[model samples]
Target: MKFLVLGATGATGGLFVEQATAAGHEVVVFVRNPAKLTPRDRLAVVAGDVRDARALAEAMHGTDAVVSTLGLGKAKDPANLIADSTRALVEAAEEGGTKRLVIMSAFGVGESLPKGSAILRFLYKGGRATFADKAAGEQILTASPLDWTLVYPVLLTGKPSTENVRAIDLAELDRLPGLPRISRADVAAFLLATAVEGSWSRRTAVLTTGR
Candidate 1:
């Protein structure tokens, strides 16, 4: 499978690229600065802004699946960047005939907040802007006909892959216990599995290190 990863420059995104390539899948990373990623086998870099639909469409040509790990890291400003990039991906995917799409979202975005655990709701209280931005982006993807899987991972950590990650749907949250978090490596593994196995089609799942 050929994957076009949108946030290859980020922590989780970089992990995904490495994992995907290690698994023998071809990977393409769209980034503003290609030099940030050292060239690796089975990896191709496409340089461009995420909001450019025409450029994204060109990159999406022959892409088997598109994965977005894009996020604003500590730039407290409220820019609807997620929404803007999502719009471009949706348009580019439509134009390029790419069907499978996987997106990284947080636990409190959209209905995840209301349907989430108490701890999740409280933790995201001060992240109104960020959550809203992610929700807006998710709204666009949800409305599309593509095979999309929205992954809502609770607070991410830098730990190595637990290899015990659980992908739980919203209704099954009650089955999970305590304050949940997942390692970026685990998230990357799940994202790659979800795309490759064609699982969780058109559904939103909450990812966590089940206790």
Candidate 2:
């Protein structure tokens, strides 16, 4: 499969690119900085901004699927960059005639999870503005004609994958008492698998480690 990644330079996005290429898929990275990506035969880098629909469409052309791991830094303003970028991506994908889209969003952005501790809820409340942006992004995808799967991952860690990840429904997720953290590598792996195998299509799944 031919794939286009929107946040190729990001930590999770980079892993997705590597895994996709390793899986023998043609990977095209739409990124602002091309130097950050390692040289790979199956990887192609395209320079562009997520806000520019034309550029995104150009990069998305001839692609079978798109994976967006776009995010805003903590230091950034509350302009909701991810939501804006997702709107642009949806428009670009629509124009480019690409149907499959897999986007990553943090858990507890829109729906309340059950296992969140006081600290987690407090932190999430503090960053409510950012999560609102993510919610808007998810709304855009859900409303679009494209076949989209939104994966809400819990707190991300740098540890390697344990292959013990499980997908929880919204109600089950909300019933939990504490948030579960998953490795970024595992998130990437799941995104790649979903893109190729079409698992969890048109559904929003909360992903986390069993432990």
Candidate 3:
């Protein structure tokens, strides 16, 4: 599979690139800073911003699937770059005839999952602006004609892959008290698996440790 990964320099995106390449797939990373990526035989690094549709189209040309792990460090800011960038990516993919897109979103964006205790929610809600932005991006992808899967994970941690993750639907999610966190590597694995197997196409799933 030829894969186009946006946010390749990001923690989750970088893990996706490494895992995808190791799986013997051709991976192209759309990045603004090429120096951040180490050169590898199976990985092609394309230096460009996600807002550039033409450049994205060029990078996405002949790609089998696209994955976005784009993250904004400051969630309190009013700007929503992910939403903007993903809209551009949708256009580029549509024009380029790519059908599959897998994007990362936080767990509580569109669902009523009680992802945190009262205190945690109160603390996290400071970034409501950012969550709303991600929610908008998700809406765009959901409405598009492409086969898309939105993988919403719980709070991310830097642990190793346990490979014990499970996908829960909205109903199951609401009953849980903030889904168990999984490693970035496992998240990457799930995304790549979804792309290859088309396991969760046209659906939004929350991923977490099955604990």
Give RMSD to native, each candidate: 1.5, 1.7, 1.8
lDDT of 3 by residue, 79-140 (tens): 86978898899999999999899998877676643645455466557667888888888888
For candidate 2, which ten residues in a row score worst on lDDT? 170-179
Q: What is the Cα-based lDDT of residue 184 in candidate 2?
A: 94
Q: How badly does each model clash, as a count of residue pairs?
A: 0, 5, 0
lDDT of 1 at 74: 88
Ranking 1 against 3 by TM-score, winner: 1
Angstrom error of the Cα, residue 8, model 3: value is 0.8
lDDT of each: 0.89, 0.85, 0.84
Q: Residue 5 of model 1: what lDDT?
A: 97
lDDT of prediction 1: 0.89
Error of 3 at 65 (Å): 0.3
Q: Please, what is the TM-score per model?
A: 0.95, 0.94, 0.93
- Give candidate 2 misplaced runs (Cα > 4 Å): 113-115
TM-score-based ranking: 1, 2, 3
Off by over 4 Å in 3: 113-120
TM-score of 1: 0.95
Best candidate, TM-score: 1
Model 1 scores worst on lDDT over the 10 consecutive residues at 170-179
